[model samples]
Target chain A: MTSGLDVRGITHRYGKKTALNDIGFSLDKGLFCALLGPNGAGKSTLFSILTRLFVPDAGEVMVDGHSLAREPGKALARIGVVFQQPTLDLDLTVRRNLKYFAALHGLAGKDADRRIETSLEQVNMAERAAEKVRALNGGHRRRMEIARALLHGPAVLLLDEPTVGLDAETRSSITGHVHNLASEQGLTVLWATHLVDEVRGSDHLVVLHRGKIHANGNAAEIAGDVSLQTRFLEMTGGGK
Target chain B: MKAALICLVAIVHREALRFVSQRGRFLAAIVRPLVWLIVFAAGFRAALGLSIQPPYQTYITYEIYIVPGLCGMIQLFSGMQSSLSLVYDREMGSMRLLLTSPIPRWWLLFCKLFASTAISIFQVYTFLAIAALTGIGFSPAGYLAILPALIVNGLMLGALGLLLSSTIRQLENFAGVMNFVIFPMFFLSTALYPLWKMAEASTILRDICAFNPFSHGVELIRFALYGQVDWMALLWVLLAFAIFLSGSLWGYDPSRSMVRRKA
Candidate 1:
């Protein structure tokens, strides 16, 4: 069976500086995978390749059984993304933003309205649908982005450091919400971040360090008696 | 086909909303042409008398002559502005969302060009209206006839803008590039003077003006404004549009773009 997301022998570089080297991982359906990496651990580069914004120098990306390089449209349609940076149109209202995204995915009219409503409600953002994005707080904006990503009902969702600047409360809530999405909606999630607290013992964890996968297993299996923080620091050597 | 049409409409709708909200941009587009019509044309009229050109049935005032060129100028600036917004969109992360969508990249880029063209047409009509109010009017038929010409010319310039946006790395670099593109394109084209009048001063400059695609674009609009067709001008503009469109498509290829290279 096709995994929700699979990356095999993926490699990328800028000149002689390797960003990602022979990185391989896979997530089954309904699994929440945390891609824990440091500042230069190729997290952004990996995200770029997965989204097809940047073609890898080598390797293949399979999204919901579709090969990204061969059938990008089919593969891309099966995934949703929430970028590390704010993608909202601050000048446009929340509903307009959702409608615009819906149209890009070939959804419109009543079908789009229904999806937008459901997605917004899922993120508890339905009440603020009429407000402009400029009026929203950072946490609310992040929630709206989550809602936007879920609008198309993709099998996999990728978020790149999604809660970077939010307050502590908002960060945990957003983390909890995405985890729930994986568990409840049977969606696969690949969340890229360095936050060790976000990963639970039972969750799938891929610890990337210095352009390599240092650990790939259940968080608890990898961490043993120590916390994920100490284990990650030891594996990455705290960056020479 | 239905989905493509919906995507096109949404892209155009977004462009329209942004245009409406940014009142300064609308003003700048009109005022630049208006200043040329009132101040520059008035000063240059006595100094540069025009003989009958093929597109012109009889000798005309400088204001009457530069009207089509001004329309082209508006489209040119609007096209560059659309490109500027693309750079901004990329910086702000909105472009990432657009690129990650399931639609073909070429289709999305074409929709952006079409949207920019639509806005350029709107600006062109507004300038034409103000020109009419100030007593420079085309044939009533000319107004309707110019729509196709405007679309063709708009796409040509918008495609050029797209090509530049894909190649140019930063927003800071855009203003300098715009100065390079906009001034040379405007001055060297038939926008200011007929080739014969230009030949009176320098054959080399006149030859350059004749070869400039933007000049052909201005000529295309000029003929259309008189309810006539300039087939040669149409052909040149269409060929340039095709070249720029293809260049933009290639420039935006994931492998070629700097965004990809940096990754």
Candidate 2:
């Protein structure tokens, strides 16, 4: 069976500097994979490749059985993305933002409305749908973004450093919410972040550092006798 | 095909919605042209005596002569404004939402061009209406004929904006666009003065204005406003549109360094 997300021999470079070096990984369905890496660890580059925003110099990405390079439209249709930066229009209402995204994916009219309602309900932002994004707090705006990403009902979700800049409590809540999405909805998720605390012992773990994958396995197994935090630090050389 | 059409409508609707919310943009678009038609034209009327031009069968006042040019100016600025917004979207990350869509990238870009062109057309009509009320009017049929010309010219200018946005990485650098692009394009074109008038000044300057695609665009609008077709101008504007659009697509290609360099 095809995996939810599969990358092989993926490589990218910026001038003479290598950003991602022969990175390869795979995740099964209903799994919350934490792509733990420090700043400039190539997590964002990898995410960009997966999202088809930047084509790799040499690599292949398979999203739900479709090859991204050869069949980008079909592969892209199967995935949703939440970028490291906020992407919503602050002047538009939450519902309007979601609706605009829905239309980009070819969903419209009543179908778009239903999906918008369902996604908002999932994120618990249904009550704030009428409020402009500028009126919402940082956490709520992030939730609205997640709702916006989920509007098209993709099989795989990719979030790049999504919890950055939020308070600890809000970060934990968002993390917990995303974990529930994977476990409850059979959605495969790749959550890229530098925070070691966000990775659960049972979760899939992939450590990226300086353009390479240093570790890829269950979080507990990768940590072995030590804590995941120590293991992450050791692997990334304190993420310097 | 159906999905593509739906995407097109959504993009256009969103642009229109944004246009409505930004009331200042609409006001500025209308006011800028009026300032020229009412104030600048009044000052230049006596200085620049007008002979019957192709589009003008009889002697006309300076205000009437520059009306088509003012229409072109509206689209030119509207196109650049749209470009500024695109740059803002890129820096602000909203463009990621657009580029990641399942729809073809070319189609998405085209939808944006179409939407901006639509807005430009709307602004042009608003200006023309106010001008008509002020006693500077064209053939009733000429008003209708100008629609197609406006679309072509708007697309050409909007495509130029798209090309610029794809290459410009930061919002701060966008100020240079107004200086290098907007001012030169507006002033060098036949928008403010006819090419013959420029010829009277200097052959080289007239030649430069003649070669400027924006000049052809103004000529197209001018002829169409009088129920005439300038075949050469139409072809020149279309050629410029195609070149600019293709360049933008190349610039936006995922394999290229434009998007990657920004990231």
Off by over 4 Å in 2: none
Return the top candidate by DockQ: 1
> What value of lDDT does candidate 2 attain over all alpha carbons?
0.92
Best by lDDT: 1
Against the unseen true structure, what C-alpha lDDT does each candidate score?
0.93, 0.92
Please write out the lDDT profile of model 2 over residues A35-141, one tens digit for every residue.
Answer: 99999899988988899888999989999999999998999999999898999888888888888898899998999999999999988888998999999998998
Q: Pairs clashing in candidate 1?
A: none
Reference interface contacts recovered per candidate: 0.74, 0.75
lDDT of 1 at B19: 99
TM for chain B in all models?
Answer: 0.98, 0.98
Candidate 1, A1-240: lDDT as tens digits: 779999999999888999999999999999999999989899999999999998899999999999999999999999999999999999999999999999999889999999999999998889999999999999999999999998988999999999899889999999999999999999999999988998989899999988899999999999999888899989988655
Candidate 1 error regions (>4 Å): none
